[model samples]
Target: MDTDLEILLTNDDGIDSPGFRALHDALSEVANVVAVAPADDQSAVGRTMSNEVSVEDHELGFAIGGTPVDCIVAGLEALGPAPDLVVSGCNTGANLGAYVLGRSGTVSAAVEAAFCGVPAIAVSLHIPEEEWPREPAVEEYAEACRATRHLVELAPVRGVFEHADYLNVNAPIAGEEPAPMRVTRPSTVYEMAATQDGDSITLRDLTWETLGAGEVDDPEGTDRRAIADGEVSVSPLTAPHTTEHHEALDRLADEY
Candidate 1:
């Protein structure tokens, strides 16, 4: 346990949510972990930030009445001391694939941290459909958090953050036997769908259904496939947008 090592913790789920509390308690065992999560649920809100936010001191840390990104900026800049690493989630659902990277608040929190020049890890649990509509117990988060704590312990010294802006990790909900860990990349497949009704346009993330059915031909080393195969998926990712050389754009500019 590196008591000297500090961690800034935040989540899309409210600070009091079982998953957030569970992870906070679990990581506290490994380092000086502080919670600066939202005061209310902010699931799927992406990297939205509030112009101003309310902050209240809580037993674990501060509960920010704002988005996960707001919590990160507030925590790192004003809440307390700068932390060695920033960790987001232990989210209730798997945040897999490239389609969800920008949409998941848990993942977005990590993205915000990377933009703020901090290495981050976004963690989530893949709760099976059988367990839907019920809260997962704190104990249930144990195995998933084992993967998280291990990464927290080694990632800094291992030079993982040197190359990667952040890591996106999703662990299967705990089973009698802990699942194995796998290195993966975000699957590039996009399958979002929407149905039009007279007054309502229903949007569904078809990817979830595909994953639940184990019917997705998710390729060999992608995050979704690892979760479907009962393994913890760890994806090292760079934060900034990349641009490739484009001859078409060059010709267009020349014509102009």
Candidate 2:
């Protein structure tokens, strides 16, 4: 077994963001870490990959002028030696629920790594609405750094990535004792709201505001409920879109 591990760390937040830097510094304690993140914030950009990416050098590592997916692909294909693990985020905010898993550029980096058959972890901090000070702050990301460190140190075990193609971690703010770590699935509940102006449509992100109010039907073990209850939520996710047998499609194929 390779005692020394190499880790590729990236985030949707720009390379200069505190969250990304904190995570990079913390993970360096565990293994050799490489940072390949966007030059600017790419949050909620999803798995979209830019055809053209410009790379620049940073103190931490390389900052690519592209999406999270671009960073991961460039890191794997051309950045450096292939990493033993890929870690995304220490994001500014939590990445929870089914709606977010598909849309979060932070998690999308991990998903992009999983597609390359590399084990990956995506970590984020859950900043409660009440926790925000009168002034906007990004200090809560330290909690996420702590969680990422713990997971990285302990990930040398069997089956750590066996069932979960990639791990999605959402940690509550700092000063909390180890909340019960629950293995969960992404919640289906979504708070997508949109409005129309005279000529343009206006959309709003209501997920952060309505963190306390959740759906009644949300199951016992889901990323949403686990986070709402102030626990560290760990959801195991698989890469690749699922393919299922379709009788109707099969009939159409036969007609062809």
Q: List where candidate 1 sits over 4 angstroms from the true fold.
A: none
Candidate RMSDs in Å, in order, are 1.2, 2.7
Instruction: Residues 1-256, candidate 1: write the lDDT tens digits.
Output: 6488899999998999999988998899989998999999999999898999999999989999999999999998998789989999889988999989999999999999999999999999888765665788899888778999999999999999999999999998788997899999999877879999999999987778777777879888999889899999999999999999999999999999
Give, for candidate 1, the lowest lDDT window spanning 10 residues. Answer: 128-137
In candidate 1 the C-alpha lDDT for residue 25 amounts to: 84
lDDT of 2 at 212: 45
Please, what is the TM-score per model? 0.97, 0.89
Q: What is the C-alpha local distance difference test score of each model?
A: 0.91, 0.83
Which candidate leads in TM-score? Answer: 1
Q: Largest lDDT belongs to which candidate?
A: 1
